[model samples]
Target: MGKLLFYIFCFLAFNSCIELNNPPNIQGTWELLSATTIRNDSSIVQDLENKRMIKIINQHHFAFLNHDNNNGKDTTAHFVAGGGAYSLVGNQYKESLEYCNFRDWEGHNFTFSVFIKGDTLIQEGIEEIEELGIEQKIIEKYTRVKVGRKRNIYATPLM
Candidate 1:
């Protein structure tokens, strides 16, 4: 009985240590490192190389923005932005779009498997952009960034 009690104590201690050493929180401003669209036919598309993207997540809502000022083409404006409330349940992250630059996307809901690896966040989901005319698997990798100045226009990192 004493040996069994000792073993249980050791196991509990080890598990508690793991729970205490949780990784960095995911609520922060993340700068887009790469955005890739993978199609069912095994083709890939890279569309944000020259664009600057910032993802901001607070306690209940999140926003994503792509700044295209460097492209020199103002199709509509200097940036394209989308935002809405979000819910996180286990590994399933869901977003209900309430605001978008394009009106067609106003009532859309999106689901993604969100994972934070080291200082980078990886999001994988199926996206059906109205203009694209097809459903594609979108994967975005972002790294944590700190905004230094107020005029930068990018979001500040979460506290």
Candidate 2:
């Protein structure tokens, strides 16, 4: 039965090697941690900032509310959009918006790194904000909850 055992091993290896870019399981709540804006030449800007909350309902829909962290007011904004796709292949995730209705925003694409350890999740990426004409790299941490937690859910990456 040595040959049979080898065949089974090969089968399992093949299935395990299948990498999905932007896997669907990431469809949940992700809170923002920290962000830094960079110029085209990779220079850090002192005044640029961003704080956000991202919610992915499914493979084709997601919502986001981002605000300036400088004000410290913790303002809330809403975005409703459809026809978007996301996937996590290896350690990188690509989030794309086919059409979004958040003030002259459409076809926006962003890439970030995702790490999952136990129930904690972390996402980091350089997100493009066309309205501000700048790109910012953000590091976000999160913890999974049952959706009934009495917290704002988007308060901090993990609450």
Candidate 3:
């Protein structure tokens, strides 16, 4: 009985010291690094050279804003903002777009498969809107933004 008790104690101690691995948390601000859109048997890579976009995520919601880095001076300067509630289960993420500058995109739900490696996140999904005649596969990569760092050169309050 004494030997058995000693062995059981050793096993319990060993197990207590072993840590269980958990999935990385996805809550934070992420900056768009690259985006690729595919449709109609053609693929196009978005031009992000003169623009900055960032997505902010919290417990249950996410918001994104994109604008030209030229402070709206360029002829093609434009801005887009949208946000909504999101649900994340494992790597499956679903966004319920409640508000968007584009009225047609409001109330739409988009689902994407997300993967995070270190500080980088990659999202891939298909966006289809029959009424809008839009169907495309989008792959976007983002880098997590660190706190206290300037999000972009054309900084606004949204950052």
Candidate 4:
């Protein structure tokens, strides 16, 4: 009886661990709610309230844009844009930077933590800033933008 119960427990546990839908289809636009950076020593650097940010993901590609002054595309100062191939495995998200504003960033693969709960998406990543010579942790929160919404320069990165 003990062995039979053990086998039943194992079966149930293993079945629960299986992923019915691995790597969900998340090909759409996302509006950035917040972008914050935390230093290795626990110092936090947050983006200003007026800062503009957006992220767009397709079947196998993704794009991200961040700017401070987003009056329009013509005069978007402090603009930073990057995108490339992307893959999601469980809670892990990885991207290859094929093109970006910073030349040094291209051809690099960045992997980070990602969680999509309903319309909200949270991502956390760690990067080493060469200039600062310290490790920086980046946390970004976003909300999925449904279709037919008004797309603007700051909110729509792909468009």
Candidate 5:
């Protein structure tokens, strides 16, 4: 009886570390859930709130689509950055975006802590605001909707 109980305990412990929905390949494309921009005020709070959509082409590339429900205006911006990386641990994924020698923003690094469950991906990170040219971290959250099917970026161009 004691041996059986020990085995049960071990099984439960091992299974707890496994995520029910393993991280999806998530290599193709994804769309953003919201749109916000840093305010020019002292606090640098995000303002001009609007429902925004973003498409992540891959682990390295992404696009931001802005939507104004009040005015019915839509605009999209394509961005490509180098040295971005992603990793998965259990059900959690870590994504890093580096403004590596980019035009306006350089030497800027942003890290996100995310989790994948079922068909949803939730990411949370801190965005630093340069106040008086001083950097201060501000918390931000992002939800990405995985569309249709997961296609290999190498096989086809992400739309």
Candidate 6:
């Protein structure tokens, strides 16, 4: 019985030394609350009054969709969508965009500093595309979507 006790103690000691490096639990549906873009000579706050945007994040992949909330009634109606793989190390989040409706933005990687406070998530990062002549710092805020007993109309069907 002495040898069995020694083996058990050793197993417990080794298991205690092992650290599980699990990333933050960000897998869910999030809605964009606000977005601000800063350029060299201008800073613009995106007009979200008539727009709706949501992001869906899983274990290793993420997708986003944005469109006019009015169902394309206005002349300025727009729609955009993209999705790809992402990695998160602590507060540093990197997204590898593989598919986008805007072809020019595909295959680009964007790194952001992410902070989550309760139900709100804020991401700040610089976006630069040489071919597009765009270099801007963007800060985006999102709120986690809570699904209640009834089905949420905003929840998109995940394939």
- Report model 6's TM-score to 2 decimal places: 0.78
lDDT per residue as tens, model 4, 1-159? 999999999998887667533665567898787667887567675654556677999888999987776565554357789999988887788888999998777887777888777777788898664654647788877878878877433332121
Better of 1 and 4 by TM-score: 4
Worst 10 residues of 5 by lDDT: 150-159
Candidate 5 lDDT over residue span 36-141, tens digit each: 3343454443432444434453654433344443455445222334444556544445545443334444445555555544434455554553533634444333
**Model 3, position 156: C-alpha lDDT score:** 19
* Candidate 5 to truth, TM: 0.49
The 10 consecutive residues of candidate 6 with the worst lDDT sum are 150-159
Predicted candidate 2 versus true structure: per-residue lDDT over 92-132, tens digit per residue: 77777665656455677888887775555777788787676
- Highest lDDT scorer: 3
When sorted by TM-score, best at the front, the candidate numbers are 3, 6, 4, 1, 2, 5
Q: After superposition, how far is residue 45 of candidate 2 from its true place, in Å?
A: 12
Query: Any runs in candidate 5 off by more than 4 Å, and if so which?
Result: 20-25, 34-50, 57-63, 67-104, 129-159
lDDT of 4 at 67: 76
* Candidate 1 off by > 4 Å: 1-24, 69-78, 128-133, 147-159
The lDDT, on a scale of 0 to 1, for candidate 1 is 0.75
Error of 2 at 44 (Å): 9.5
CA error at residue 82 for candidate 4, angstroms: 0.8
Model 1 Cα lDDT, one tens digit per residue, 66-115: 87755656563367799999887765788899999987888788888887
RMSD of each: 6.0, 6.4, 7.4, 5.3, 8.6, 8.1
105 Cα displacement, candidate 6 (Å): 0.4
> What TM-scores do the predictions have?
0.69, 0.52, 0.80, 0.75, 0.49, 0.78
lDDT at residue 104 of model 3 (Cα atoms): 97
